[model samples]
Target: MPPALLVQATAVELLALYRSRSASPVEALRAVLAHVERHGAPLNAFALLDEERALEAARASEARWARGEPVGRLDGVPVSVKDLLLTRGWPTRRGSRTVDAAGPWTEDAPAVARLREHGAVLFGKTTTSEFGLKGLGDSPLTGITRNAWDPRRTPGGSSAGAVTAVAAGFGPLAVGTDGGGSIRVPSAFSGVVGCKPTFGRVPAHPASVVGVPPHVGPIARTVGDAALLLSVLSGPDDRDPFRAPPPREDALYLGALVAVDAPGASDALDPSGALDARFLRRVRVGVSATLGYVDLPGDTRACFDAAVALLRRLGAEVEEVAPPFADPGGVLRTLFAARAAHTVRELGPEQRALLDPAVQSAAAQGEALSAVAYLEAERQRAELALAMAVFHRRFDLLVTPTSAGAAPLIDGGALPPSFAAPFSLTRQPAISVPMGLTSAGLPLGLQIVGRHFEEALVLRAALAIERESAPLRAPPLRAS
Candidate 1:
C-alpha cells in the first residue's frame, strides 16, 4: 500500500485504514512521519518527532491486526500531542527554554498515557505558547507556528501548532490545552473544530496551572474526530487533585453523541443529531457582538448576524441578551495574574527576562495582585458562572463572535479579552465553529456557549451550523 493514497482521512478514516489491510499500521505511521518531516519546517507545526519509536509501535499494531488481536479503538492512528503536555519521548518544554530537557518525565501525563494505551501512535509534539500563557503562537524555544491556510496570519494560540498540524494534514488528530481560548481560538483561526470540554473533563496539571485555570482537550477538523479523541483522553488522573469525578454514565459525551445521532429524532435530537431535542422554531439565543462592551468590527458583527439568521432558519429563536454580571474581566485579570505569578515567578531571572514580552508583562502584573484581590476574583468568578447559568436558563444558548474580527495577521497583537475569557473564567463549555470567511479570505468563527458540561448540545448546534456553513476544503498543501 502506498502512503500517498490516504483518503479524506480523519480519525475515522485512519481507523478504517487499519481495519482494512490496504495499508499496514506501520505504513500509516511512516506516511504521517514522512509528511510531517517534509512539512514540519514550513509550518513549524511540531516541536519534536519520534519516528523510530512511533514506527515500532505501529509495527506492533500491524502484528496485532494480522493476528486478529483486539486493540483500543485508536490502535494505529498517528496523533500529535501539544508540547505543553508531558510525553515520555519528547521534551515537554511548554514552548520555553526555562525548563531543562534532561529533567524528570519518565511517564506520560494521564491523557498522554491513555492515548498510548489506546494504541494511538504519539509521533511528535506540537508547539505551544510559553507556559501556554498567550493566545498567539510565537515562543522563545520553538519560534512561530504558521497558519496552514495563510502563513502570514496567526494560527491562534497556546494550541497554535496543534491545530496547524491537523489543518496542514501533518496528522488528523492533535491534543490541545486551553486556558483562555487556547484551543478554540486556534481551531477557529485555523478552520478546524476545537473542543475545550467542560473544565477538568480531560484532567491535566501542567506546570502552567497553579492559578486553577487551563484544560487539555482535542483539536480536529471535525466534531466527530474531536469526540473520538476526547473519549480517549477524558477521565480522572490522580495527580490533579482538582479532577472531577467521572461524569454520570448517561452523559458520557461520545455515547451521548451516538445516542443523539439516532434517525427521525426531531424533538429528541436536533438535525445535527447530538442534542436531546430538535430545534424548535424561535428557540431563544442571546446574540452578543461583544459580550457587552468589547468593540466589534462591522464585518465581524455582520458575519455573526448571518450565523444567527441561519439559526433562525433552523427554528432557533434569536434574541439579544447580556449576562447580568458586568466587568467580569477585572476578576479574571486578577485570577490570571495571581496564577501566572505563582507559576512563573520562580523562573531564573535570566529566563524570565527572555520570556515573551506580553507574558512577562502579564506575569509582572499578576505578581502584584494582593491576596484580597485574588479572593475577590474567585468570588467574581462564582458570580459570573451563576449569571451565565441564569442566562442560559432563559435562553437556550448564547451566540457570540469567536473573535473581535477575522483571523489576525501572524504578528498582530492578541485579541481583546471578551467572549472567550469570560466563559473560560466561568468554566462553561464553549465551542468555536467556523462561520464563513471574512472578505479578506480568513475564516470567521462563531462561539456557542452551553450550560456547564452540556457539550453534547453545544456540539449538536455546532454541527448544525457546520452543515449550513459548509466548510470549504482547504486545498492540499501542494502535495507537501
Candidate 2:
C-alpha cells in the first residue's frame, strides 16, 4: 500500500495487512510517523512522542508476526496514551506546568500496562487540559490542540489530543480519560468514535481528581477498533481499589458488533468487511436532541433528528422521548469543583502559580462550598443515577447529541457538554459516534447511552449507526 493509504488504515486493517504479509508494522509505523512529522505541530496533538522506542517496538512486532507467534490481541498496533495516564519511562506532565517533566517515571497506569502486555506499540503521550480539568483543548503546558477539521477550532478536551491524533491520522487508537465528556467531546468534534464505559469498568491507578468516578476509555476511527481496544482495557488491577469486578473472563467486545453466535465473525465488521446490522432490530432507542432543558442550535438539532431517522431505517424501534430528567450539570459541577479544590489545596505556592486559572477558579469554588453543600450534591448525584436507571428500564438505549454543537472556534471554547455531563454523573456506559456533518462540513456526534455495564449494547448500536448512516469520511487534514 502507498504510505498515504497506510497512514489512514485502521488498526484492524493494519492487522489484516500484517497477516497477509502485504505490509509490516515497521512500514505502518514509518508511514504514520512521517504523517505526524508533516502535520503534528499544527495540531499540537502530542505532549511527548517517543519516535525511537516506537520504531524499535514496531520492528519487534514485525518479527513476531513473521514467526506467527503474536503475543496478544493488539500486537503491532500503534497506540497513544493520554498524558494523565502514567506510562513507563515517560513523564506524564498532564498539560500542566505544575507537574515535573523529568522523571524516573517507572510506573504504568493500569490501561498502559494492559496495552503494553498486549503488544501495542506505545508511541507517545497526547495533550490534555491541566489535570484534565476542563472541556477545551488548551492547556497551560501544551498550548492548544486544534481540530484537524479546521485548525482554528478546538478538538474538545481533555482527550483533546487523542481525538485530533486519531482524526488527523497520527494513530488509529488512543487512550483517553473521561471525567465528564473528555473522551466523547473530543471524539465528537474530531469526528471519531470514543467510549466512556460504565464507571470503574476499566481500572484507574491513582484516583481521579475530576469526575465523581472518572473513566478511562478508548478513542478510535471506528467502533470495531474502539471495541478491540476496550476489550484490552477492561479488567481489574490491584492498583485500583475501586475498580469494578472483572468482566467475564472471555469477554470479546469486538464480537458484540457481529450480532450473532458465530465463529470468525469479527472479520466481517471491519472497514472493508460486511457489517451485520441485525442487532438494531432488537434495540429500543429513545432519542432526545435536547435533554429537556438544554437548547441546541438549528444545525445541531437537524443533524440529531437525522440520526434518529437513520436508526429507525436500520430496523431500530426508535421513539422521540421526553428528556429522562432535568440536567444534572449543577450537581456534577459541584462535585467536580470539590475534587479540583482538594487537588490544589496542598500545592506549593510555585505549583499553584503554575496551574490553569480555570483550575484555580474551580478550587476556589470548591473551597467556598460548605461540606453540607458538597454532601447535598453527592446525594443528588445518587438520585440522578437512579432516575436514569429507571429511564433505561423503559428503553434499551438513549441517544442524544454528544455536544451542544459542532466544534467551535478555539478561542470561543468547545461546545459545552450539556448533553454529556449528566451521563457522567450517572456513571452509565456511553459512546459518541459521528452522526453527520453540518452544511459547512463540520462533523456532529450522536451519543448512545446504555444501562451501566452495558457497553456491548452501546457498541452494537454504534456499529449500526456506522453501517446504516453515510460512511464517515476522513477529515480534511490529509498528510502524506
Candidate 3:
C-alpha cells in the first residue's frame, strides 16, 4: 500500500481491512510505526513512540484473530493518547519537567482501561502543555507541536499532540482531555472532529476534582471515529464520583448516523438517533459570531455568517440570539484558577518552577481568590448553566465558529479563543466540525452545541452539516 493511503484511512476502514484479512493487524501496526518515524521531523507530535510495545500488542491481536477468539471493537487498531493521561509502562510527564519519570503508575485511568479492554494498540504518547494549562501545544519541557497543514502554524492545544497525531496519521484516533477547549481548540485548528461529551458522561476518575468541568473526550478525523472512541470511553466507574448513570439508550454513536435518515425514524417511539422532522424541517438555530462580547477575527465572522446562511438554505430557522448569561469568561477564569491552585498547592517550589508560566500565574491567582469571590464565581457558573438551559429550550441547536479563526503559527504561543471556555463552563456537549478552508489554506471549523447530555442531537446536527460541507483532507507530510 502507498504511504499516502496510510495517511488517509480511517479507523472504520482499518477495522474493515482487518475483518476481511486484506491486511494483517500486525502489518497495520508496522505502517503506523514507520509513518511515525518518517514524519517525526516535520510533525513533532509525539512525546514517546513505543514501537516495541505497539507491535507486540498488534501481534497478539493478530494471533487472537487467527484463533477466532473474541476481540474488542478497536482490536488491532493503533491509537495514540494524550500525555496528560497516565499509562503504566510509559512515563507520563504531562509536559512538565517537575514530574518524576520514575513515579509509579500502577493503575490505568478509566478511559485508558476501556481502550485496553477494547484491544486498542497503544502506539505512543502525544505532547501536552504543562498540566494542560495553555491552549497552544508548547511547554518548556516539550518543544512546540506544529500544524500538519502548515508547519509554520500551531496544531492547537492543550491537546496539541493528540490533534497533530490524528492530522499526521500517527493514529486514526486519540484520547484527549478538555478542561477549557483543550480538545475542541486543537480539533478546530487541526481540521479534525473534537467531541466534548456532557460532563460526567464519561468515566474520568483519577483526574476529576470536586466541581471542575474537566472531561475526557475524543479527537479524530471524522465524526464516526469520534463516536466510536466515545463509545469505548463512556461508562460508569467506581473511581469517579461523578460518573453519570449510563444513558437510557445504549447504542453505538457512530451507528446512530446510519439510522438518522431512515424511514419512520422520525416517528419511531424511541427518539434516540432519529431527528424530529417537524423540528428539524425548520430547526431553530441560534448563531453568534462573537458570543456578544469577545472580539473575533475578520474571517471568523464571515465564515460563521456563511454557515448560518447555509443552515437557513437547508431550511432551518436561523437567527442571532444573545446568550442568556453575562461575562462567563470572568467566572470561568476564577473557577479554573481556584481549581488549579488547589490541585497544585502541594508541589514544592522547585517542582513549581518547572510548570509553565501560564500555569504558575493561574495557580497564583487561584490561591489568592477569597471565599466570597470564589462563591460569587460559583454563583455565576450556576446562573450561566441555567441560562444555557433556557437558551437551548428556545433553539434546537446553537451554532458558532469553532475557533475565532484558523490555527495560529506556533511562535511565541497561541491562545485558546473565548468560544470554547464558556461551553466548558456550561458542560454542554459540543462538536467541532471542519467547515471550510481559509484563503490561506488553513482549516476553519464550526462548532455545534446541544443541551446537556444531548450528544445525539449534537452529533446529528454536525453530521448534517458535514454531509453538506467538504471533507477536511490531511496535509501531506513533507520535509520542512
Each prediction's number of clashing residue pairs: 4, 0, 0
Count clashing pairs, candidate 1. Answer: 4
Determine which window of 10 residues in candidate 2 has minimal summed lDDT: 257-266
TM-score (all chains, Cα) for each model: 0.90, 0.95, 0.92
Ranked by TM-score, the better of candidates 1 and 2 is 2
Q: After superposition, how far is residue 114 of candidate 3 from its true place, in Å?
A: 0.6
Residues 283-397 of candidate 1 have per-residue lDDT tens digits of 6778887776778777777888899888878878778776567866677667767767876867888888878887788889888878887778788888888888888878878
Q: What lDDT tens digits, residue by residue, belong to model 3 across residues 359-393?
A: 89999999998999999987887788888988988
Ranking by lDDT: 2, 3, 1
For model 1, the run of ten residues with the poorest summed lDDT: 262-271
Q: lDDT (0-100) at residue 235 of candidate 1?
A: 77
Model number with the top TM-score: 2
Per-model lDDT = 0.76, 0.85, 0.79
Measured by lDDT, the strongest candidate is: 2
Quality of model 1 by C-alpha lDDT: 0.76
